[model samples]
Target: MTQGLKIVIVEDDALIAMDLADLLIGMGHDVCAIASTESEAIVTARRCKPDLMIVDGGLQEGNGIDAMRRIATEGFIPHLFVTGDPQRLAQGAPDAVIVGKPFTMRELSRGIAAALASGVPASAD
Candidate 1:
């Protein structure tokens, strides 16, 4: 059997972060870390080295795009943008896989699976 994916979430909203974590856990994926600020997210991501990362656009210390860029520059990880602002994401993170806010579990699941199937480091570029 395939191993469950390890995921990290970087979302400032408490309810949304918990909900997303619950959904991912319910889907049999492991949530390795959840961060509310950009600095925390960066630290957690580096420490956890998750198979996939879902980041919100808005963060306390910095934006998710900055976190993604940091992760990319540091090394490799599958990263997806889960945000409310698609326009900004389009301009700033054109290459990222996006799952808009208020996304269904099915959508999130599909995005995770797709990201995994494509290979972890593949999405970084």
Candidate 2:
């Protein structure tokens, strides 16, 4: 409903990454970059400085939560974690917005809204 956001997606699965990119584009948001690993995610975030990040909680090469924690050192960026184990993140980060795996577009949208609304500007660690 607001202006389209610049987003970076941190997902390891190639198909999932493409799907998410397409979905975001269709939703009027810009998909600046897609990162398949934690290092890539960190670098991409720094280079793109996206308005938001949709990160997979468990990456093939590294952990998404670790990537986010490292990225947060630079500054807080609104983010939503997509994970199969939502309870883990919820318990660790009660204030953070998280969406479980096999999520619906509606769920993703709500998580994005909540993350942006939070706007705490603090490290996600």
Candidate 3:
């Protein structure tokens, strides 16, 4: 798929993660890893150095923001937050790109592009 953006998916639900993986692959992006908890996400991100991460707003063990914060220490790893509750994350990460849950493929794509274009998550829409 032309060495598309290497992405890490951080979601607590297995079914959701699987669906996300399929979506990313269909979009020609590479899913380097899938993590279900904050700790797993941080660890995977540190090891993989993916181009970007798609993180859930609320995670299993901890939270997405905290995990992303730790992961970003290595460098500017852009992120797209997908959650039913966007308001909470917006306060913690004002400029971070986000898409509400039940996002259409178009919305997710736009968020990804916006986050990558800025090299740090940017305001989407």
Candidate 4:
């Protein structure tokens, strides 16, 4: 298996963030940081330099699409979006790898695999 990847989670829900962190640890991946807002996500990604990022498409304070765009300006980092409204994210990022909300482990794993495999770099535009 590949080495455990360092990851950052951008989720506004505290419980969900913890759950995601726990799940990632169980999967042998290390969660470097968790952010609850777009600004926080950008700062955390910069500080943590995680190999991957799992972002929520909709956030109460700040949305994920804007956060990803800002972070992408620094450099491309493998990432996936988890959201209830896939179409919304699709409209903003046509190439993004997305996992639906309330996903099973299998689905999340597949999404992560696809996200990692995708070569398209994140773009601000």
Most accurate candidate by TM-score: 4
- Model 2, 10-115: lDDT tens digits are 9999998899899889999999999999999999999999999999988999977788888888988899889899888676566668899888988988988988
The sequence of per-residue lDDT tens digits that candidate 4 reaches over residues 1-125 is: 34499999999999999999999999999999999999999999999999899999999988998898888878888899999889878888888998989999898899889888995655446
Q: Model 2, residue 43: displacement in angstroms?
A: 0.5
What ordering of candidates by lDDT runs from best to worst? 4, 2, 3, 1
Candidate 1, residues 14-123: lDDT per residue as tens digits? 99999989988887889999999888888998899998888898787798888877777787778777888767776776666778877987777776766556544322
By lDDT, is 1 or 2 better?
A: 2
- Model 2: residues >4 Å from true position, as ranges? 121-125
Between candidates 2 and 3, which one is better according to lDDT?
A: 2
The TM-score that candidate 1 achieves is 0.87
How much is 7 displaced in model 1, in angstroms? 0.9
lDDT of 3 by residue, 24-86 (tens): 999999999999999999899888889889999898699888887777665668888999888
> What is the Cα-based TM-score of model 2?
0.91
> Candidate 3, residue 109: CA error in Å?
0.6
Looking at model 4, the pairs that clash are none
**Candidate 1: C-alpha RMSD after superposition:** 2.7
75 Cα displacement, candidate 3 (Å) = 1.4
Model 3 misplaced stretches (Cα beyond 4 Å): 1-3, 121-125
